[model samples]
Target chain A: MFFNISRYLGRFKLVGCVVRNFLILLVGLVFSVNALANPNLGLPPLNIPADNPQTAEKIALGKRLFNDKHFSADGTISCASCHQEDKAFTDGLPVAVGINGQAGTRNTPTLINAAFFETLFLDGRASSLEAQVLGPMLNPIEHGLQDQQVIVDLIRQDRSYTEAFRKAFAIKVDEINISHVTKAIASFERTLISGDSLFDRHLFGRDHTALSSSAERGLTIFKNKGNCVTCHEISWNNALFTDNRFYNIGVGFKQLTPVLDKFIAFVRQGNNPDYFPLTAVQRSELGRFNVTKNLADIGKFKTPTLRNIALTAPYMHDGSMKTLEEVIDHYDIGGDQNRFIDSKIFPLHLTTQEKQDLVAFMQALTSSKSPNHPTGE
Target chain B: MFFNISRYLGRFKLVGCVVRNFLILLVGLVFSVNALANPNLGLPPLNIPADNPQTAEKIALGKRLFNDKHFSADGTISCASCHQEDKAFTDGLPVAVGINGQAGTRNTPTLINAAFFETLFLDGRASSLEAQVLGPMLNPIEHGLQDQQVIVDLIRQDRSYTEAFRKAFAIKVDEINISHVTKAIASFERTLISGDSLFDRHLFGRDHTALSSSAERGLTIFKNKGNCVTCHEISWNNALFTDNRFYNIGVGFKQLTPVLDKFIAFVRQGNNPDYFPLTAVQRSELGRFNVTKNLADIGKFKTPTLRNIALTAPYMHDGSMKTLEEVIDHYDIGGDQNRFIDSKIFPLHLTTQEKQDLVAFMQALTSSKSPNHPTGE
Candidate 1:
């Protein structure tokens, strides 16, 4: 009877072990499913606009509209033409090339992880992705649509588009408008979250071996001696590589002050800033000043994310630096001297090895598989 | 004794069947392996330059070199910038956008399966890929390299390149030159042959069910009613979709004839035609006339292969047409009127359905996997 009791206890213990293992497996599957939902980057929940929720139909319609040239007045430029997937969604040019090959003053910023930004464009004039959409579409130098009505009319004419619009937005054909267009594109853009970079693996993934010694050294320099973390922040859980704040590093500062003065005078004259041509706004190089009209924000541009920095070369506001080495060298020399230059812009006497390491670290920040990349899944 | 005799006869028959099967297997293996050796495109043996034989080291070096921006004057543009792998080696621009946003006259042509071409470039001025490499690199409007020495010097500076050159060509560090650069690039380009479309699978792989029913009907139209086979040659064994010949389709005829006359005059004045800049040559729109200077060759561009044609859009030498519909429409009307137009080019009175069928057939010619496309393998 003692032997039988002992045997029963052993079977109970075995069953307990099986139940425990099954629970662990269930937990792992749940964790993996959650991970799959947010983003590969392992960042906090994405900043999805409340008005525009993501849907499959919306994304599909947005992709089609993005590729269609008929959206432009000249029927030559599509959004994809400039925001090319292969080039990390930025045209590889010093300035943004637009309708009839007319160039804008500012560099075409990468759309990768743009959903996280507090504002859009170098000047931070636009508050939301929706507001930014029409700025380019109707800009004289960009898509050059005569008006928003042109796009609406084109959509109305297409039976397929009408069906797509109705399905995506639950609206009638006549109700198809810019709100739907921007909402769809914004939804699509939000999905372009390039995460799971080797750097992310090293930190959040708890994989110490993910980074090479060179990349490790670079990370140290970026955080500590480099002082890049001040602007391009690293939070406890994630690294966005952008503080989403504005500062002047002395690039085009001297020239921009005069333009800022002119802009201020124009504002005093009761001129609506919206009427300004993109070229005029570009010429101002006013940066954050355009948004607030504050003197302190003069010559200050938003800090761009260092993610996928390798793919989107010709860095900074005007795209003056063609190589990472050039950008590093610019920082090392404490930037070009100007009155508006931020106090934080100081020289870094980095060793050659440190510079190489820093560049390597930045490169490591690049995603293992950029979702919107040409060859990416 | 009777049972043994019958068994021996049965064994002999079995052995005979085995031998015949083995022979068939050997032949099939040899055929498949040979097909794999060159490219998926069912073409004749590629015309590899004797001086620039393909090597793993050379191809690797070439790929890096193709992507290196330092090869350009401004250190911004790379060969791969305009000839992007995502867009089948052609930039999406109507005309090639080069260094400092300098636009070229002709459309950026695909480097895919260019190993089979008798000539390179839209005008066929360059006879070999090796010869073609320097044209773009040194063109003021393209890579903007001041001279061939710039490329040679850039390679010499890089330690990795010095080692790569030695392994590729058994050359000393000092021996690195333009010839080596072109040889390496050309060798790499030769490997980019994307074939194996559904059409190819049907024709070569003997997969009858590979093509959609619509595509099959389109193929019949392409061969018969469409008469695309006249220039885009369709042989029983293979379909190159190019006759390896030139023909005038009335594009740039009047303007080119005047320029051709001036070129003749310029040649008469002791100016070596070869000395003209690519921009000048491109401006002429002389087509094959630039190479041979023959009156019959005027306004005659080389017939480009239809392989992966779907990806390399903004078609034609000038890139005037943006869509497949526009291209088909041009052909349906037997091209615009010109004195030098190919006699074989005549009106195809295709119904809307037939036109759609023909377009579908041409699209079927596109590779299943564009070798150089960003999304492709």
Candidate 2:
């Protein structure tokens, strides 16, 4: 009997060695295949969190959950309400609209390259994509959920979601929570990487003929004369086209000027989460100041990514400018002059053709697979 | 006899090992001590070329050579004529007045942080500081030397210079040449590092009380609204304040626009070093295009450092704007409109107070020891 037990143990040890080797190979294979090279966009790699590894099942569940209206206070709204896939994940609105036709103060920024952003939102409040999902879901003007439990309860009750949670997270039905939901949604959002553009082909691929001659000239103006490359960065290897820092380019500074003192006093008041409701206009105008409350940050808003900028219209933090030309014109005049305006916004004495060329160059930034990927582009 | 020879050789080998170890220790010690930290300026180590290392004797010799007027055709115009120490190493002239009062087309840029420049000169023609010394020395309108042989012959004849050269370079008097002269001058120029600005203290040293509240607000404008940080870069670790790239900010573009086609044709004719004499204005206006012959590079001039900007009067390539206010106004108006003007140049509608704040902030950038360092403040 002792001899038999010893032989069985030896067999088990051999099986264990084989299993360990297989796992090592599998990990190596996964890493080698998935080092985040989105060749189409010339992107480096997606920063996937360790805790929430992307599974096909998780991504599918996230996509379904992203579209599910049951997560909202009213059945009419979901995450997709404002971020429609057709408009490069934007609703093509000046500001986001919520349940019962409630309106948001700020313009809807596109989610094309949100994964690469250091901080989310025009005000740059959220530090991560996972955290940003909760902002709109709870905001009275957006998804309008009462609290975290509402989302968790909804997931637990749904049979499909329960199954999805089990498959994605290896959790029981009771374990379905807001954190898992956010993780899944963020995971889905991460896959929305788009890089293949005419400009990308011309620049990174060294396909000189990819860009139009006018676009090429426009690029020079954009880089040199326009000084746009300062805020919209393009490194030697990659071009996120955003410095990801805040600046007040004089968009809506005029309205805030008259009541600047009053607004400052209001924001200086002790921590109030519900400040957005009472001071929607003030909050929108305050921009980054609403977050940091630093005097230097007054009227500052995060520089949005110029990737797929053409599809998302009604530009600026307030959605004040309509066309790209108008936006250019505003910048040409060096933004509205205010005490707090960023000094960099000087008048660019660009001629009409040069302006058109700048527009052309920006147009070239549109990804070939964007404005609803795999369907609309 | 064999025993004696082997014993002697063994003794020599033991001495050689001690000598080699000592040499290694010496090199390691030199590197640790001279790793290029200028605490006052918070600058990184100066990039000393491997071929021409910095020595105290070499720097002193270069300083003497920098002030020596005999190098000019008429013993009046040394490097100091254009780059005067009292004027923050700038002539404080709208344009450089060369030998016999011949006016060059561009303003004399500051040499405060010039050692950090990737390329030398306003047009960025010179590849290195060593190469740059020849341009002004040989320029018929500037120092007006007939050839390199004249300077070499003059240096050989001078008793003090010959001895200084010997001490600095460890070369025989007969071995002295233009390259040695330039190397010495370049080495001296490299030591003109400045970082002890009030702004530097505040930004880099974490000394919040260093900057005035007005200057602090102005910094915000300079960073955000002015967008000047685009060309004048400030990294997290260091602030070179120059992107080292060229742009056409519409400074001399107006003069180039009418004659741009003719100018292109003239530059396209072929390599002509003497082109500067005949087409002085055209050469200056052509900017970076003269160096590369690339059509896109027209009207582009290297972004000069803003360090000690307050000391250097008559800003811009042409030096048309006399004061900081005038320079601000020119930028405010978007730099006199032109087809090739950098699109980044937009009308900055700065309030009078804001403009003053910007000036104050720039003034804060002046190193505490600048404007004739170790002498004037």
lDDT agreement with native, every candidate? 0.77, 0.80
Query: Which residue segments of model 1 deviate by more than 4 Å?
Result: A1-39, A257-282, A371-377, B1-377
The TM-score obtained by model 1 is 0.45
lDDT of 2 by residue, A1-377 (tens): 63454555556788856665666687788864543233455554568888888889899998998898887788778888888877888888888898879998988888887888899999999988888989988988888889989999988888888998899999999777789988999998887778877788787776788789999998887766687887886654467888788988888888777777665565567545335343567657878877886656778999998887888887888888888999999989888988677656778878999999999888888887774433234
User: Which residue runs of candidate 2 sit more than 4 Å off their true CA positions?
Assistant: A1-39, A264-278, A371-377, B1-228, B231-377
Model 1, B1-377: lDDT tens per residue?
63454455556697856655666687789987665443465555566777777889999988888888988988889999988887878888788888899988788888888888888888788888888999989999999988999888888989989999999999998988888898888888988877777677777767688677777887766755565664676544456777677778776566655455566577668787767544453445768877786555667898888887878889888888998888888888878877567655656777898878777766776675675433343
For all candidates, state DockQ relative to the true structure: 0.00, 0.09
Share of true Cα-Cα contacts across chains kept by each model:
0.00, 0.22
Global fold similarity of model 2 (TM-score): 0.52
Per-model TM-score versus the true fold: 0.45, 0.52
B141-182, model 2: which lDDT tens digit per residue? Answer: 899999999999999999998999999998998999889999
Q: Residue A40 error for model 2, in Å?
A: 3.6
The best candidate in terms of DockQ: 2
RMSD vs true structure, all candidates = 33.7, 24.8
